[model samples]
Target: MRTLFIAIASVLLAGMTIMSCEEKDDFVPTLLLDVQDAIQVSNRGGEFSIDVLSNLSWEANTTANWITLEESTGEKGKRALSFSVTENENDERSSTITVHSQEGTQAELTVVQESGLTLNIFVKEGAEGSGKSWEDPTNLSNALKLAITGSSIFIAEGHHTPMNIVSGGNSDDPRDRTFEVASNMTLIGGFPAQASSGATPDPDAYPTILSGELSDGNNSYHVVTISAPQSDEEQVVLRGLTISDGQADGSKSSATIQGRDFRREYGGGLIIGGSRVVLENCAVKNNTSDKYVAGVYVFDEAEVTILHSKLNNNASKSNGGGLWANNSTVFAYHSEFNENSGGTAPAVHAYPNAEIYLFNSEIRDNKGRSFGAAFYARADSKGALVNCLVTGNESTSSNGGGGVMMYDNCEMEIISTTITENTIKGPGGGVYRRKGENILSIYNSIISGNTQKEGTMNIDVYESDADPAKILASTSGEVVFDANGQIEEDAAFKAISMLGDDFTPIGDDNPALTYGMTPNHLKEIDYLFPESEKDWLDQDFHGHDRSGSTTMGATLPE
Candidate 1:
């Protein structure tokens, strides 16, 4: 019996030893994930981390190109896996980082990066909340501050004045007083609280105004100034606003070159320098400047494009009451310049090395005290006017060229245009070229009813003899010339009236209706048009189809 009990005990001990060995073989550490299901990041790019609660080794990997894991592998026991993302320039994106343990357990952390923000502004109403929607619109001043690059600002209808305090002082500095637009930004006005079916806002229904009403003694400020440097990758756009009441009195100093003090009153309404600016459906009126360009000024290699806009009732003490461009490229299309007064070139003045293009527009009812009541091109400037109308413009000074004045070494081309009813106090009521060898080419155009008060010549090339055939040519239609490109017959307009925000010609017998030849240069320079603009050269200023009978002036008869 003793022997049997010992054998049973030994068997039991052996069994216990085997059970212990099996338990040791099956031993494994537990692994767990302690992190949020998802996380959010800004569009500007940032870093974040996730906590891993595990008793084993873990690894993490990202599934997106923009997202990257900083620490892909980590040890056990509450380890942090870091990750980062790049700046989101296109749109919102999402990615996931999967963290897996050696025990085959896995966890995911979803990351979402947002796109750029767009703000809204309503000056009439108060800003009370975030400016993401119409109901929570902010002020224009605040919206400009909150907006980042590539962001857009939609301004509702109201008169928005500049913030009087910029960088804490109201000094004579333009950067401190004017409304400065940032680079790569789009500012659109004339929007209602809610838009209709159409994507574009109607300027007539929602009249957005930007006024500069702060009277700082005699030193006035410009309404808007764009001095930001723009590249080919980015552009700045300003549209659908009435910019008025700007007053620049030539009191502020711009520079001291050669012991002379230059003024900073070039642009009363807007000044664009070293920027790429586009102005569409805008009205710049009722602005005054003591120097040049009461309406708009472009300088320092700026590229400006103005389309379907109006520049009226602006006054300048010097040149270019409507527009002044110095060493810049300016393209004005389907626009109007009326009732502007200045010392010279009431409608437009182009300085040396400036390139100006005016197409399918009107320059009328303007007064220049010196020369070029309609348009002027200084030395070494290049100007082209296509299918434009220059009429009812007067030059009050003793200089010539009420319709157009081209200085020495300037080049000007007028194609399919009309020049009528312009008066000059000296010579060349229709057109004038200065004494030097300048080029003034007129093709398929008309020069009629222009009077020189104190001179006999209607089109004068002062001391620069020009051949009538070489200087004037026509491809398809007759280039009308009545005694040195001046016709005594009436233009026979239905009415020369400003009728309710519309300039209309009501007569069917107008001479400009049937004498026009569309040139190939119109399509070659079509790149000047904005991306949103359609083929407008085939259309009139009133949006009438010109495929039937192309009109010489800006307007087409219905």
Candidate 2:
């Protein structure tokens, strides 16, 4: 019995030894990925690098794949090594390596874009009749010459002396004659119209003018002909400047024959024959031409964006006293046009084959003679106005659209806008959508307060033989407010107070605050539930809360 016990013990000991050997073979350390170091990021080529460290049995582990260092450029590369990771070979303490691949690697490379520079522009200040004074340091006419010649000129906040810009190179003289606005630049002036002293004895006279006078050290002599950009990447940004009285020099005989002819041919605040231009926070006022034209005339398939600007008090002989766009794609946002008069046609005219988009803009107080007061769109024009205000416009003798008068076969859409307070001497005060397979869609907009000399709310659809246009509206949406999330009718309850002569707004318990609400479109529900949160009232340009819940109008304080 004792011998049998000894044999059994020997067999158990042998089994236990085999089990221990198997457990030892399965013991493999985990490979750790380590990347903690300063990396070189190249902007020109979008290259970046990060070092990686691995400390484990990488040789025998055939399943070990790679160590990836993720970056914002979205690049990832892999390498497989067959070796036990030694401290010297596997530990990358301060090694830098390039990431040659930029693919689906979003790990640590989220780049947040910040706002670009703010360009402020100032034009002539001190009242309309006062000659421009240099008391304010921002008289940048001379610096503007250098800036307009290239890109990025910041006009100061002082009244500019009456000046003209003449291109140094003449087409005929060739005496080192070359003038160009050839760079992607930001020109900023007319910021807050400074107050200074210069005598403008004639109350009717303009203090500063940009006319066709090249020889008297004035630069505006060279017509700003919009030629093709030398490169597609170039941009021209005009901001915060006032352009007044850009007249053709018929009064001066010394003006170049070509220059005078160019002025006579194309005269306005800004004449566009180029592409990809942007105008923001500007005022184009009181520009006139003898021939039929517009305050802002665009042609030749230009892609123009007009934002936060005012085009007012301009006069023209024929079409488009305030704005004229021909065969172009134009987007206007947060803009205003007031009190423009046209002799022969509409205040805002779009030719055939034009695509115009207006967003959160106001068109009011415009007058025309024989046609629509606010807008006259032709056939083949595709237009859309979202959250807009078109009111208080008039026409003398004809079918006038205090809001809009579209011809046959035109396409138009309006969303969440106010088309009210418009009047006409003849027909169609609200809208005159004429005959011809025109498509008109209106959703969530107010079409009230428009009156004719005889009738009111005159929406004439297909008065002649034309296809009835479609006017669509959301069943739940209303237009008595603006897209800035306020009620338009509420502003009428409280009288708005002006802080100073600037006519900027300062809100004080106005009832016009609670109008627009888009709950489903809310980015965050917490915005409406700001319980015990501090009120951050931001004011607009006219010194009012642009996004306040207590006031009306566009000026929001920052």
Candidate 3:
């Protein structure tokens, strides 16, 4: 009996040892995965897979309803698990899929989706609830947090400041909060929504205002800043909005242009850097900066297109008051710059390889303490003025350009533009041509009523190159008026049709009306916004058609 018991014990011990060895040979110490930190994806729902390497059975599960796995349970041995996601129609989302082994070892895989345009993010003032639906609205600062790429945020009709401050030990309006708008997004204002039926979305009637006037006279640095790099081809668009009452004060920044270091605080109303932006039917006014530009500042790689907008009544201590571009481009279509006062160019200033292209716009009633009253442009750059009215500007500083100051080596093409009633305290009432042989091609344009305190540029400096300007008829006179109110040069040129005195179709014959009405006699004119195909304005500045009246100016008679 003792021997039998010993044999049974030995057999049991041998079986137990065999079982332990088998389990040890097939054991996996740790489950390791070779995957990216995060995966970036796009709009539509599609199949995605991830490889899992293990020696046990694994099951995949996700909390997001948009995610669907083809197979939940899998025998893990370096195999790919396929999953599908639904079409996204909201803001950008990040979802994670948790994978678990039979031994309770968990791993996560995350997928990120880009924001879609179908989602509507409505923002109003003084609402502190969830911003999901129209019934519960949020403030602009909160909505900006959810504003990702390719998103559209609708703002309501109220005074929306960038920040709402609460006084405390150190929380008393630091003046650092700004509307840091992202690239490839749209911010449309003038929306009034409550529960269901919002207003008809009239910008003027609703009057959505974005003010930077913080309490206790603590102003923000910038009202709006569009400085993010683009993920797509879409631009940062602001439509039917008003950017006003901003004061860009405090710490100055440094910008380099043409190997020169410029230091100043820039862009009180709007500052654009390394992005494409558009302002449609908007107004940028009542903004102030200690130095640099007050209304708009376009930096490197930035393209700002203003269509049917107004830049008025902004002030700066130096440089541009309305608009300034440095090493970038600014194109305006049917826009107006009026009543901006500053040092240098008050209406518009382009410098250090920047370009300003204005088509069918008006530069009027601006005051500049120095340089050009309408524009101060330096050479090593290019610009154009087509179908524009430059009038009622004054260069307060002595020996400045009344209408425009073209300094150093540069090129500007003036076609079918009217330069009238602009005065300077010094030379170049029409234009101050400095240094090198500047390229000022005044083709088929009118230069009248421009004046300087002394040595007016009407016809005084014909000795300069390309000067005895190729001019058309004028309403009054060029700078210093002559007996005949006409320039001395007789070079006749043809150009595209621009605006008359009131941007009204030429109805009455002015004093310097000398040419005849013939479209075939005009040369082809290069205009801006080639995407619109036909160059000339279908409707004039006031949104009125040019009635078929054969006139003497440069516009094509329909």
Each model's Cα RMSD: 20.0, 21.8, 14.8
| Candidate 2 or 1, higher lDDT | 1
Off by over 4 Å in 3: 1-118, 164-173, 193-198, 254-264, 459-511, 516-534, 537-558
How do the candidates rank by lDDT, highest first?
Answer: 1, 3, 2
User: Which of candidates 2 and 3 is the stronger one according to TM-score?
Assistant: 3
Which candidate comes out best when scored by lDDT?
A: 1
lDDT of each: 0.69, 0.47, 0.67
Backbone collision tally, model 3: 5
Clashes of each: 0, 41, 5
- For residues 58-126, write the lDDT of model 2, one tens digit per residue: 211112222223331221112231122111222122222232222211112122111122232333432
lDDT of 2 at 215: 44
What tens digits encode model 1's per-residue C-alpha lDDT throughout 20-133?
466766645444444346665656676766556655688888879999889989886567777788988766778888888887888787887766544343333335556776
lDDT of 3 by residue, 419-458 (tens): 7678887877766667665666554455655677654553
Q: How do all models score by TM-score?
A: 0.67, 0.52, 0.70
Cα-lDDT of candidate 3? 0.67
